[model samples]
Target: MKKIILLCLTIVLYNCNGNAQKTAQKTEQKAYKVSKTDSEWKAQLSKMEYYVLRKAGTERPFSSPLNKNYKAGTYVCAACNTPLFKSEHKFDSGTGWPSFDREIKGHVAFGSDNKLGYSRDEEHCATCGGHLGHVFNDGPINTTGKRHCINGVALKFIPKE
Candidate 1:
């Protein structure tokens, strides 16, 4: 029994890496076409926008006026003005955030986020690496079946001309 207990303890200790985490935050980040200094981003974005786009924070549900906006326009990255979701893809998800069925292909990048314990698909502006939000499998069946639940502050509405 003593030997068995010692073996178990050794195995547990061996599995740990001196408090280092096994995953989540990566050592190096992918390069983006539009990069800016921390100060620049803070200066350009509003307080709430900075929180959502740069800090990966969520805004209060139903707080964003864009949530109920039904205008025909394009949604661009608030950080870099990169066109992301089109007006045609926008949908009222009843989720309080500006939801979209799809993004302009190749403009948005996908990453893994396990911050919520379970894994979630993370979205970012491919050009600026701004935190847009998460994408889920739940969406219109006739469409792409992707619900890109994005933060409104992370986006800017551009009316069609």
Candidate 2:
């Protein structure tokens, strides 16, 4: 009986170590090395944008100037300048945040987010791993229930001329 218990403990520890290693590897692949200084980012972004994008802060819901921006444009990553969301995907989720139903292929990555102690999809810049926001399953039923709640500061809208 003691031998069996010892074997189980060993297996649990081994699995835990394996999981930790895998998590580390995944983080390494997703992390973006900062090449720009804080001053540089500040210069490139407005004070509010810098606060949300660079500092990983969230803006108050329904307060963003872009919440109602319904123009045709491409939404790009504020950090790495990668195009992530298309105008067609943008929708008003009525949650006071910029919502998208889809993203440009290969530009955004989704991961399980438990930031608020609940399971949700966390959206990030695929190339830069910058935190954009979380996704939920409470969006429009005509489309998928997926609501990609994005931080305005994490995006740059480029309107088509």
Candidate 3:
């Protein structure tokens, strides 16, 4: 019984990989306009921002204050300050996090996420490669038909002047 248990544990440990490298791996091969060392990122970002951006971790739904924001402004990358989304494209997806109908052209990048035993469309900042969040097809009609569900921690809103 002990031998079998050990074998099972070994197999589980060897085959099941965590989501730790999910974002990092995706950014490694692609170069971003704004690059920073891990230490630099940690020093600059808050703990929650670091977790959501660098580690590709998800923030709790409806937890972000930005989710309810409806002001005119722009959402920029929290890590690199790269402009990503506009308030005009924002919407209430009710899935929490800040949902947008679209992104600022050329500011966001897309990738694949399979951490949940299925495939998901992941998004990140094209400027710094910071993990933003995932995009889904279930969005408002008569528009882009794409929901860019982004992590608020990964963004900082700059009100229009």
Best by TM-score: 1
Ranking by TM-score: 1, 3, 2
lDDT of 1 at 46: 96
- Please identify which of the two predictions, 1 or 3, would achieve the higher lDDT against the true structure: 3
Query: Where is model 1 more than 4 Å wrong at Cα?
Result: 1-24
Write the number of the candidate with greater TM-score, choosing between 2 and 3: 3
All candidates' TM-scores?
A: 0.88, 0.72, 0.83
> Scored by Cα lDDT, where does model 1 land?
0.91
Model 2, residue 17: distance off in Å is: 8.6
Top-scoring candidate (lDDT): 3
For residues 30-96, write the lDDT of model 1, one tens digit per residue. 8899998899999999999989888889999888888988899999999999999999999999999
Q: Comparing candidate 2 with candidate 3, which one achieves the higher lDDT?
A: 3
lDDT of 3 by residue, 2-106 (tens): 999999998887666644456667677888888889999999999999999999999999999999999999999999899999999999999988999999989
Task: Please write out the lDDT profile of model 2 over residues 1-161, one tens digit for every residue.
Answer: 99999999999999999999989967864445445667888898777777776666788998877789999989888777889988888898888889998778787788775667888777878876677988778877887767889998788889988
Comparison by lDDT, 1 against 2, better one: 1
Candidate 3 residue pairs in backbone clash: none
